[model samples]
Target: TLSQHPDKNLHKIAHTRSSTGPLAERVRPNQLCDVIGQESFLPESPLGRLLVEDNLPSLILWGPPGSGKTTIARIICRVTKRYVVKISATKAGVKEVRIIIEEAEKRCALCQPGTVLFLD
Candidate 1:
């Protein structure tokens, strides 16, 4: 399990490596279909079920930092097999956001492959 890895000692291997938790250690999801969370909106919401089941759509997780928003988004991207693009409103400007959206929109038929935009 990732929880059991010697993440604390990763500093010895790489000075830039973080040791907060496994959640931030990895990037992108291994499988979107395997994502977990948002049970309350399941079976009812179209987009919610897609996120929890089909692993499709752009996800805008609105909340403060360290709230599992990025973790959940990462999981969804993994299971869905769609391209995952991460961005931060804090660091990005409207032009940058537009560029990312335009690029992500180009995925699949709309514009590559399917995309799961995860904005933090």
Candidate 2:
């Protein structure tokens, strides 16, 4: 279930899972500058500029396992200070999307920060 205050768990989620989760999670980069191998998306690039402006548009990150898709999403959420709602597209149906959208509408009505619908 989506929490009314999703941002409340942002810090807790990032810190708590890294300690006991997989090695990859434990060593994941917390900032865009710390990521390697994807230099095209780093600072000085268009994506980097957008991130700096905090105006990153809806994007789709497609990559194989072990890639930095989730890591990038986390960094975006943190940098933008937005609520994140992660959903697995493979398993998600219209029902899930409707729920997320509805929650986003509520947030917007309240003048809260935007929600990042990170479809994994």
Candidate 3:
């Protein structure tokens, strides 16, 4: 009877829906609590504590592939209420950078929190 059930394919359908996105995109953490590792570089660290409190200075995150740099950047921007404009250095040129800066300036002038230019 189970083999002849009309919903026999339900599990396959659920699996397909759950695994729709790319592996990396699907697994990317949406918040700090979901992030793993890099504990020493977080607010707990001496140097990082100041940055976390102020959340003002521009940061340059350098690390190997899959090192959670993007995740950390996202978390910082989210916590600071900053807008994020992601750009790729390899594809973006001076013109794009200038445009982003001008837009950021306008947002800042409006008393918006700030912007984080995540250069990937």
Candidate 4:
């Protein structure tokens, strides 16, 4: 689990060299402080404070290509101990979303970690 205090862990996320993915995924920042260019979302910042206090609320992150939007969402999930369900809006239709929501509901009923839908 991540430390609630944002200033503490300014280190990179640990992963094995065997992990395979796109370059961005391989190099993604696991810690909030390790994320660059989005200081407003850092733990010391207001938004970061809100996240620490209230947990993650529904949000639509907008940024240019290669920005840290996906990384931020995944980090939030880790911090909150939630399972992330990533889907691209262009590929997933309403039925697919409904299916995810239903599965999430089932997980919630089983007292599992809540789901964080990361619609890209």
**Could you tell me the TM-score of candidate 4?**
0.66
> How far is 92's C-alpha from truth in model 3 (Å)?
1.3
Q: Tens digits of per-residue lDDT for model 1 on 30-89?
A: 443223454533446676566556655444666676655666666666556667777786
> For model 2, what is the alpha-carbon lDDT of residue 104?
98
Cα lDDT tens digits, model 3, 1-120, are 334546655444444454877545644666554566876555677645755675657778888988888888776766766788888999999999999999999999999968889887
Reference-based TM-score of each model: 0.51, 0.71, 0.65, 0.66
Off by over 4 Å in 4: 1-16, 19-22, 102-113
Off by over 4 Å in 3: 1-18, 41-43, 46-54
Better of 1 and 2 by lDDT: 2
TM-score comparison, 1 vs 4, better candidate: 4
Q: Which segments of model 2 are wrong by more than 4 Å?
A: 1-19
Candidate 1 wrong stretches, greater than 4 Å = 1-38, 41-49, 52-55, 64-66, 109-111
Better of 2 and 3 by lDDT: 2
Q: In order, what is each prediction's RMSD in angstroms?
A: 7.1, 10.3, 7.9, 7.4
Candidate 1: residue 12 lDDT (0-100): 42
